[model samples]
Structure formats: structure tokens, C-alpha cells
Target chain A: MPRADARANRAALLASAAQRFAIDGADVALEKIARDAGVSIATLYRHFPHREALVAATYAREIEDLAEVPDDGSGSVALARWLLRFVEFARTKRALGDLLHAPGADHPPARGVLLDALDRILTRGRADGTLRDDRDPADVLALLAGLWTLPDDDTWPVRADRLAGFVLDGLTTTR
Target chain B: MPRADARANRAALLASAAQRFAIDGADVALEKIARDAGVSIATLYRHFPHREALVAATYAREIEDLAEVPDDGSGSVALARWLLRFVEFARTKRALGDLLHAPGADHPPARGVLLDALDRILTRGRADGTLRDDRDPADVLALLAGLWTLPDDDTWPVRADRLAGFVLDGLTTTR
Candidate 1:
């Protein structure tokens, strides 16, 4: 098989596996993922030697690109940008939420990408007098952790907007 | 048994049940709760009628008097008062967290009590121009939902304080 075709097949399998993992959780069958990806089982095995490798790699790919999500400036604008990203990921992340939070599990890749992004923006906001000095980025992250409980349906967007707006105001609105 | 003695037994059972509920969750066994109360199993059944009845009544009695927790004048002071009440209840309430959030569960008796208290103070703050108009009491309550996830240990008090303070600042801070 051509190298380019092999690479395309690997990408297809990851995409398919990601959806299955998100929906069916971490234990979905490899054969099912291969069928969904429209790739042979042999190709899935070639790309991922073990099930954990497959799950972790697919999950990492989902969040890896977020490391580059630009901060649209600072203060509320930057905070707002990062929050939307967080909310979006959280919406889909709930399907695999157990895995993400599993105790003693290996720390997932791309873990700090979003939190670091938030730290940068919050640091800028603090310097500019737009953000309060006492708030911690970790606390803000914990506050956002509640977002995981929100329902995944039409009303989710509205609820997410309310939560994100509240957090944003809490951090950026100074007395 | 005399009426006064029965009342005393009931009060003692509730105190034991409340402490166990906070530490062990809403599902702690009635027999265990009875032992802690130093009361007989027959007496617990007589007073509560059933396990659910005991759980509900005990939990209700915990937050029941919150109706009278004084709302100091207005603004941050009043907001702070209500938040402390909220954090304290949330600490124990986590025991019944599943029931509180269960889909289609009748809105728990305690659901709107704290929200209404928050609304009262926030309304006062807005009217007096000491609080931001853009904030909502329900939104603050949602942020406080994160309080349930904090670990059960010494740090809980400190973490709750931080979360409560963040929500207060979010509401009270003027830009």
C-alpha cells in the first residue's frame, strides 16, 4: 500500500474511533471502529497496537489543536474566547467524561493546552486592571468544571452561554 | 413514651443522621443512623415511618431554618451571608446530590430556597447600585454547583471559601 493511502486510512480510523469512544465510552470494540472508519481491521491494528493506544491517541487528536487557539486580546475578550473553546470541548467531552476523570489513569495528553491558554489571558487581564488580582486560574477552571453536568441538547447552548458569561464577568469585572 | 421524650429522641436522631449524611452521603443506612443516635431501630422506624421519610425529613430540617438566616442590609455583606449558608448546605447536600439532580425528580424542597435568598440580596444590591445588573442569581447558583465536586477533606472549607468569594466578586464587583 502507498504511504499516503496508509496515512489517510490512519486518520479515518482515528476520526471514527473518536466518535465511537465519545458515544459508547472507552470499551467499544476495535472491529466496530474499523467498520465505521471504512477501513480493514488489519489497518486499525497497524495504526494502534492496543486499545488504550487507540483511545488515548484519538482523544488527544481531538484536543491537540486547541493549544493554538489564539487569545483574541485580553481581559473579557480573551477570557470570552477561551471560555467558548472550553464550553465546546466540554459538550463533546462528556461522552468520555469518565475516562478523562478516571483516577490513576495516565495523565492525558493536551491536558494543559486550554488551562495554559487561560492563564496567559488572565495574566494579561490582571496587568491591565481589567481583571481582579485575587482570582486564580485554577479556581476559574474548577468553576467551569460544573459545565460538565449541563445537558447535551438544544438548551445546552443557552445554558453554556449563561455559565460562561457568569464566569467571565466574575473574573473580568473589577470593583 | 411521653411527648417531650419522644421529641427529644427525634431531635437526637436527626442530629446523628445529619452528621452521617454529610460524611457518608444520603444513602447511609437507617440502622447505622439509629445506632449513632443511641436510639432503638424500632424507635427510628416509629419516628420516620421509613428510610426515605427519615432521609427527607432530616435533610429538610437541615436547610429548613435557612428561611430565617438574616439578610444583612445589602450588597456584598448580604451576598456573603447567603453564600456561607449555601456552602454549608452544599457540603451536606452532596450526600443527596444524585437525588437532587436526578432527571424528572420533583424539584427538591431546598431547590429554590437558596436561589430566592440570593435573589433577594442581589435585587437589593442592584437597586442600590452596589452590584452589577448583568448578573443573575440562578447563574451564581450554577457556578456554586462546582462546590459539590471538591474533595471531602480539610481543604473543603478553604475551597468552598474560594468558590464563594469568586461568585461574590462576580456579582458585586463594579466595572
Candidate 2:
């Protein structure tokens, strides 16, 4: 396969893996992931070599998504969007569970990445007078920890969104 | 012992159990609890036939504490006070762990009591225009679930307070 085709296939596989992992958990079959990515099982193994490698790569992709702060100039809006992403990240992380701790899974520092992302948004918001300066990013993160405790049922998404919204409202300046 | 003395001893035992359980967890020595209550082992046993009975009674006391909504007339202030108590309750609940689920423990319906307490407060707050009507009491309860997730360390009290404050801010009408 050409280099560009290989890159596309790798990206597709990662995306498929992330989606399946979030929905079906980390034990989801690699072959099903490859099929969803419109690739063969051989292609999946050629790229990832093993399940741990694929999970780690997908996790890295998630952290990268969180780190990429939009340059929208509105801190509140950026933070709001980021919070929704954070909720999704929390869900995926919960789904990933012990897989991230398994031997040979080389994922990045999630807490550090998340705190930095939150700090950047909070700093921007405070400077722009869009967010309250009373809260620390760590405090916000701690408050958002409620996301992890929410029951993993059908109403999880709605409950997670509401919890995030409450955090956001608390962080925003009283207009 | 007189009826009033017996009642006092029982109340003291429950209070002592709540404190010790919150600090040292459910397995704290029964003798220690008896000592803390300034009572003999026989008195403690007379009031609570077994550890499960003590745990159940302690749990019921917590629910009653939560159910008592102060008529302070300011829903925000009342809710704020209640949130702090709720945090303490969460801590004690965490410490209780499986004790509450022990086969013979006859604790009241915790979730129902909590939701009803919150509903009463939210209704009062909405009536007095002290709280935002957009969020449901259940949503507030869900958001406050962060208290349960805080690490049970030295900083837990501080972190729990901050998280509760954030939730309070979210529920209060913007001034």
C-alpha cells in the first residue's frame, strides 16, 4: 500500500476502534473494528500489531483532540465546546477501564493533558472576563469527576451533559 | 436505667457511631464507639443489638438529618447549609460502604429521602426566587454526585466544599 493509503487506513482504524470501544467497550473484536473501517483484519494487525497497541493509539488520539483548543477568541464558547468533548472523553476512558492499565499499553498522561487543556481555557476565559476567576482548573476537574460516577446506562449521556453544564454555569461569570 | 437516660445513651451512641464511621470506616471497634459515647459495652449493646443494627440506626439518623429542611426563608442559604450537610453525609456514606448493604441492615430508602429533601429545598428556592428554575432537583442531585467521587484523603473536606459551592452557584439565580 502507498504511504498515504497506509496513513488513511491507520486513521480509519483508530476512529473505528474509538467508536466501538466507547460503545462496546475495550473487549470489542479487532476484526469488527477493521470491518467497520472498511479494511481487512490483516490490515488492522499490520498497523497495530496487537490490541494493546490499537487501544493506546486510540487513547492518544483522544488526548490530542482534547489538547487542540479552538482559537475562537471566546473563552466561554471554547470551554463549553471543550467540556462536551471532555464528557465524551470521560465516557471513553470509563469504557477503556483496565485496558489502559494492561501491560504494553503506552498511553500518554491523561490527567496532565486534561488539566492543561482546562487551564488554557480557564485562563482565556478569565482574561476575557467570560469566566469566574474564583475556581482553579483542578477544582473544576474535581467537580467534573461526577461524570465518572454516573451510572453507565442509557441516560448516562443526558446526565453527563447536565453535569457538565452545571460545572460550566458555575465557572461562568454571573451576568 | 431510666427511659430518658436510655434515650440519651442511644442518641449518644448513634452520634458517636456517625463520627467514628466517617473517620475510621464501618469496621471501627464497637468498644471504641461505646467509649466515645461515654457508655459501657452493655449500654451500647442494649441500644443496638448488633453492629448491623447500629449501622442501620446511624444511617436512618443521617437520612433524618437530610430530611429536615430548615425554614430559614432563604432557599439559597438553606440549600447552601444543606449542601454542606449533604457533603458530610456523602463522606459518611462512603465510609459506611458495604455496611449499609449488610444482609441484616434495615436502613431506610436513602435515595428517596435525598431526592425528597432536595425537592423540598428546590421548591422553596424556586418559590423565593433564590434558585434557578431551569435545573431540576434531580439534576442538582446528580451534579452534586461529585462529592461521592472526591478522594477520601486529608483534602477531601476542602474539595467537597468547593464542589458543593460550584453546584450551589450553578443552581442560584444570577444576581
Candidate 3:
């Protein structure tokens, strides 16, 4: 396959893997993921040599997604958007928890990446006076740790949204 | 022993149990607790038949503390004080988690009590125009769930305080 085609196939496989793993759990079949990604099992295996490889790759992509902040012109808006994305990331992370925490899982530095992302948004917000300067990004992140503790049920998304709103309100300056 | 003396001894045992459990784990020696409470082993046993009983009683007392909101005149101040007390409760709850979650352990209705306490404060705050009327007490409780997710260390108190501050700021009305 050409390099571009291979890259596209790889990205497709990762997206499928993330969705399937979240819905079906870490033990989800590789063939199902390949089928969902519109690729052959051989192609999936070529991109990811093993199940752990696929999981690690999916997790890395999620972190990268979080690190890429959307510039909405206003710091508060950007941070708010980023926080909603973080909620999605948190949901996926919870689904991947058992596998991620399994012994010796090699993945990117998720905490550092998330903190860097928050710092970026906070820095911009502070400069624009849209966010409170007294709040630390680390503290904001720590407060959000509640996302992991929420019950996984039909109401999960609503609860997650409310939690994010609370954090956002706390971070934003009173204008 | 007289009724008043028995009551004082029981309260002393509970206080010592809460302090010791926070410092030590759930399996800490009962003898140490009895000594700390200045009561004999028989007296401790009289109040609490078993270790589970003691843990349950301690948890009950913690919930009661949370339910008893301080009338600081301002609803925000009252809730703020209650929240600080809540941090302490969360810490003890974390320490007592294993015993509390053990099979068939009976305890008071913690969630109902906490929600009722929050409702009381929020009602006053909303009436006095000190807190945001748009916020739900349940959502506030859910947001404060982050308290349970924090790491237990020296910095735990500081992080807990920050988390409480964030929730309080989100719940309080802007003047």
C-alpha cells in the first residue's frame, strides 16, 4: 500500500477501535474493529501487532485530541469547548481503565498532556481576562477528577456535562 | 455506670475512633481506641458490639455533622463551613471505605442526609439572594463528589479545600 493509504487506514482503525472498545469493552474482538474501520483483519494486524498496541494507540490519540485546543478567540469559550472534549476523553478513559492500568501498559504521558492543554487554555484566558488568574490549572484538573467517579449509566452524560459546567463556571471570571 | 457517664463514654469512643481511623487504617487496634477514649474494653464493647458497629457509628456521626449546617447568617457562609466539614467527612469515609462497603454492613441513609443538608443551605441562600438559584443541590453534591477522588496525602487537605472552593464559587451568586 502507498504511504498515504496506509496512514488513512491506520487512522480509521484507531477511530473504530476507540468506539468499539468504549461500547464493547477492552476484550472487544479485533475482527469487529477492522470491519468497522472498513479494513481487513490483516491490515489491522499490520498496523497494530497486538491488542495492547491498539489500545495504547487509541489512548495516545485521545490524549492528542485533548492537547489540540480549539481557538475560539475567547479564552473562556476555548476552555469550555476543551472541557466538553475532556468529558468525552474521560468517558473513553473510564471504559479503557482496566486495560490501561494493567501491568506495564506503554502509553503517552496523559496527565502531562492534559495539564499542558489546560495550561494553554488558562494562559490564553488569563491574558484575555476571561478566566480567573487565581485558579491553577492543576487544581482545575484535580477538581475534574470527579469525572472518573461518576456512575456509568444512562445519566452519565448529563452528570458529566453538569460537572464540566461547574468547573467551567469556577474557572471563568465574573465579567 | 450512670446514663450520662455512659453517653460521654460512647461519644468519647466515637471521637477516638474517628481520629484513629483517619490516622490509621480500619484494622487499627480496638485496645488503642479504648485507651484513647479513656474507657475500658468492656465499655467500648458495651457501646459497639463489634468493629463494624464502631465503624458504622463513626460514619453515622460524620453524616450527622454534615447534616447539621452552621447558621452563619449568610447562606454562603453556612454552606462554606458545611463544605469544609464535608472535606473531613470525605477523608474519614475514604479511610473507612473497606468496612463500610463490606457485605451486609448497615448504615444510615448518607445520601439522603447530605442532600437534605444541601437543600437547607441552598434554600436559605436562594431566599437570601446569596447563592445562585439556578444551581441544583443534587448537582452541587455530584460536583463535590470530586472530593472522594483526591489522593490521600498531606496535600489532600489543600486539594480538598480547593475543590470545595470551586464548588462554592460555582454555587454562590455574584453580587
Candidate 4:
């Protein structure tokens, strides 16, 4: 493992990249991302040789963060809460879809990471019987995929909140 | 008023356009649509001066079809029934969003039409107390927006079906 300062630099660069990707497109300049993260351009490339590598790593960390959303005692409730955070993930990752799903690529680099997190949460819910067994993690992910289609306009935040609530209500408890 | 044969030609052209637009894109050739509809190119142009006009009109007709989905007698059940139909509407309309949301356009031409249908269904549900009053037609549409985001893979149909069921369950009578 790298030393603490190196790790911190990596984290900061990734955070900067995610923020810029959300605000602008994924093609926001590497120099700007490095400056925003308080690191030099050389440091960023030292950590991640290619921009795609940085994007993939940042996305992996996001999935890790999603996986780490603490259980709120209620299995279904925990999944519901995690989904509220997932809206940002869904929308932000969409900006990177074209990049991650580059020509000839088999799957999005982020997809498996995201799906695995979903699987863990869903598996816990099923184990506890707090969620509808009939619902599959794959299906849940597919349902959440709708988030990518929303118009990013003034009403998007409100719409996203409503959409998240809809998913939570629909996915948990017996039908 | 258009004569009987002229009216038939108009309906055929619109039907052909909608079919072609769904299978292909909104930019499908006018000649091809006319040929598919068994009308001449002149008839297609006469009916719709511009491709945008045909897209808007076909989209309007789709909304009318949605509005005409008969209530299954139960207010909530009626809305549930209509949402299954709404998927077809949502997916088919995805191809037309660009055409319908041309420069300076405030909203998709079909939005008000579909939302009106949703509003009527929801209002009835509220009156009957079978649906949650807090959920508005706009919110429901936002939730359903996920419908258009699904991948066009073999699994799409299954995912779409699950998503529709999720929406119905989430919006209906309280737990």
C-alpha cells in the first residue's frame, strides 16, 4: 500500500474529478482537476496513468462508499436510505458512460461495482425478509436506470427526490 | 372538413409515421412512411408540412390513446392498468423528444397531453382514497421516466415490466 500522503493525494484528486465531472463533463481538463485537488499534474498522472484509469478508480470508490452505507437496523430501511444517495451516483455516472463504455468495451467499468453493491444490500434484505423476495437486485438496478433519463433542468432535484421515494416504497416490504 | 378518403389517408399516414418513428427514429424518410401507409409522398407532405408536425401530431394521438385507456373500475387499479400502456408510450416517444423539443421549446409537445391523462387518473385516485395524495402526477411521471432509460437488450421487456409494477406499488394505497 502507498504511504498516507500519497493516499490522501489520490483521494483528493478523485474527489476533485468527481465534483468536476458532475458540474462539467468528464472531459474537464486534468490540470484543472489537479489544481482543484491541490495537487500537481504530475502527481495525478503518477497515481492514475490515464484519465480513464482515474475515472474508473473514482467510480470504484463511489461503489465502495455505496457499499459502506451503514445499516440502519432495519434491513429494508437501510437499502432505502442507500438508494437516496444512489441518485447522485446514477446521474453522475451517466456523464461517464460514454467514456467507461468506450468502443469495443464489454461493459461499463462502473456497472459491475455498482451492481455488486446493490446485490449485497438486496441479499441482506432478502436474508432478513425485510424486502420483497420477488424483487431482484438486477431488476432494482434496472428500475433505478430511469434516473439516467431525467431532464437535468430546474425541477430535476425535486423530481429525483420523488423518484427515490418511489423506488424505496416499491422495493421494500411484501407486495 | 376532409372527405372520407382524405381522412383515411391522413390517419394512415399518422399511423405509419408513429410506427416508423418507433422502429427507426423521428428522421425517417417521408417517402418510406408514405409507402408503408400505402399513400403517395404528396399525401404525406399534404397531411404534415414538416416532419416535426407529423411527430407532434402522432405524439398527440398517442396521448389520446393513453387517455382513452378504460378505467378498470377501481381508481388505483385503473392507473396501474394505464401505466403498462404508458411504457409503450414512453419508449416510443423517446425517439421524438429531440424533434418535439426543438429550439426555444418550453416543454415536450407530448408532456402536457400525457400528464393530463395522468392527472385525471391520479385525481380520481385521490378522491377515492386509493392512491397517495402526496404523490402528484408530475412525481409519478418522474418516477416513470426510468422507463425510457432501460437498455434495449433482450432483458428490456422483463425489466420494464418489473419497473411498471414497482411504480404501481409505490403510488397506490398506503402500507
Taken in order, the candidates have interface RMSDs of 4.0, 8.5, 6.9, 5.5
TM-score of 4: 0.66
Q: Model 4: residues >4 Å from true position, as ranges?
A: A1-60, A67-74, A90-107, A149-155, B1-20, B25-54, B69-72, B90-105
Give a tens-digit lDDT track for model 2, residues A6-124.
99999999889889987787678989999999999999999988886787788886677788898887789888999998888787676443342221223335555666888899999
| Candidate 3 chain B, poorest ten consecutive residues by summed lDDT | B99-108
Model 1, which residues run further than 4 Å from truth?
A1-58, A69-72, A96-114, A124-130, A151-153, A173-175, B1-20, B25-56, B69-72, B99-106, B173-175
A best-first ranking of the candidates according to their DockQ comes to 1, 4, 3, 2
Clashes of each: 0, 0, 0, 1
In terms of lDDT, the poorest run of 10 residues in model 1 chain A is A98-107
| lDDT scores of the candidates, listed in order | 0.71, 0.76, 0.76, 0.73
Computed on C-alpha atoms, the DockQ of candidate 1 is 0.21
lDDT tens digits, residue span B10-116, model 4: 99998888799878766688899999999999988898897777888887756677767465566698897898787766665766544432222265556666668
* A44-132 per-residue lDDT for model 1 (tens digits): 99899877567767767656655555655657677778788878877776544433332222444444455576677778888887887
- Kindly list the per-residue Cα lDDT of model 3 for residues A76-163, writing each as its tens digit: 9998898888888777676544332221223335555677888999999999999989877767776666565555677778878888
lDDT of candidate 4 over A1-175, digit per residue (tens): 8899999999999899888887776678999999999999999999999887888887776667776757556668778778878877666575555443232225555665666777778878888888777777656665655455566676666767777777777767755
- Report per-candidate DockQ: 0.21, 0.18, 0.18, 0.20
Q: Best candidate, TM-score-wise? A: 4
TM-scores for the candidates: 0.65, 0.63, 0.64, 0.66
lDDT of 2 by residue, B37-60 (tens): 999999999888988678878888
Q: Native contacts recovered by candidate 2, as a share?
A: 0.38
